[model samples]
Target: MASILMLTAATRRERNDATSFVFDAINACGGWIEDVHMYSNKMTTVRLALPGTAIEDLIGSLIDGGIAVDPPEAPASSDDRERRVTLQLTFLHDEPDLMRDIPAIPG
Candidate 1:
């Protein structure tokens, strides 16, 4: 299913890494990015509609890229049925591996 990722960059130190992760991960995820978004805090939120159910490769890519991921969170309400996962993350741009990924926000 298609979903949105609210990747909170949190601090300046995380921007480059997070940005790199976003770019790489989106590419690895097969160009599913419908929209690319950013905030004053250096946070980037992506709207993606992946073609497959297997997110492991994508997740792994992010992790390997030096991104730290939080456990996936379940949607909070019936109104949120469209969104199944939320990931909290912190990534290191220099590493560039999926294992270094962090998951944040409503996916």
Candidate 2:
């Protein structure tokens, strides 16, 4: 089974570390990124889809690269059937824990 870890960079600010926006390295690590703009915030959203059930190495890599994570966004309706295991996330960017946990329910 494949699992996705998504990290949202809250603002336009960036860091000067080894993990500082290296697109090639991220792609090499089996990750893809989408840039989002919300009002004044230019967020860099990264999605890492890991192969198989093992997620430790990927999580470790994200942590090493200064990327923070949150629990998988919850599904709407009681019938949604995705099993999610939450990794310990770094709260550096401060997740919008209240609103973000709930995935949008399509009408």
Candidate 3:
């Protein structure tokens, strides 16, 4: 069965290069991209379709390529028919925790 996979990634490299790298990894695993959205020059989100069983292989390939991806999260709904997966990829030293620099307000 085919499933929809959404992946978000942030990189310091040029947007085109990052997109190509992601597309290459997905294509290497036999997956095809359906849609792509760029939130910023450094961030992109891609929607793709692939066999439900091949998700693991795709993640493995990305990790092997030196991209750090967060663990896939289960669908928020409890419905058993949901077949979508979302993953976030972070390029080493590219994404910083800006919130850490924000000071907390007095309670």
Candidate 4:
């Protein structure tokens, strides 16, 4: 059975680069991307379908590549059926100065 894998990642790299990096990792681990959504230049979410057996390898690859991946939750049931796995990756970056150009308020 094919399991659904949902991944959310935040990257500081350019959009194309971040996407490509994820694509490469998934392909290398014998998974295919079903869909991908780019929320912003720094955030991307991907849905993948692959054999349940390959899930560990895919997650390991992402972590080995310097992505901080959260562990997937165990399936609710013991039945051998398709399940949904969710993993989240967060990349830390310095917060931008929102008021850099704003003039100081009068005291």
Best by TM-score: 4
Go through the candidates in order and give each one's C-alpha lDDT.
Answer: 0.48, 0.37, 0.58, 0.58
Writing each residue's lDDT as its tens digit, candidate 2 over 1-107 gives 32434333322224224235435444554444344222212233333333323344444555456665343353212322332332222223443433335778999
Candidate 3 per-residue lDDT, tens place, 1-107, comes to 42444554444554466567778977776667776655444455677765565677777776665566666654222333324554454443455433434688999
Model 4 misses residue 52 by how many Å?
A: 0.9
Give the 10-residue window scoring lowest on summed lDDT in candidate 2: 36-45
Of 1 and 3, the candidate ranking higher by lDDT: 3
TM match of model 3 to true structure: 0.59
Alpha-carbon runs more than 4 Å astray in model 4: 1-15, 75-91, 94-107
Query: Candidate 3: global Cα-lDDT?
Result: 0.58
Q: lDDT tens string, model 1, 58-97?
A: 5666666656554333322223223322333433335344
Give the lDDT of residue 98 in candidate 1.
30
Error of 1 at 60 (Å): 1.1
State the weakest 10-residue window (summed lDDT) of model 1: 75-84
Please give the lDDT score for candidate 1: 0.48
Tell me, what's the RMSD of every candidate? 12.3, 11.9, 9.6, 8.0
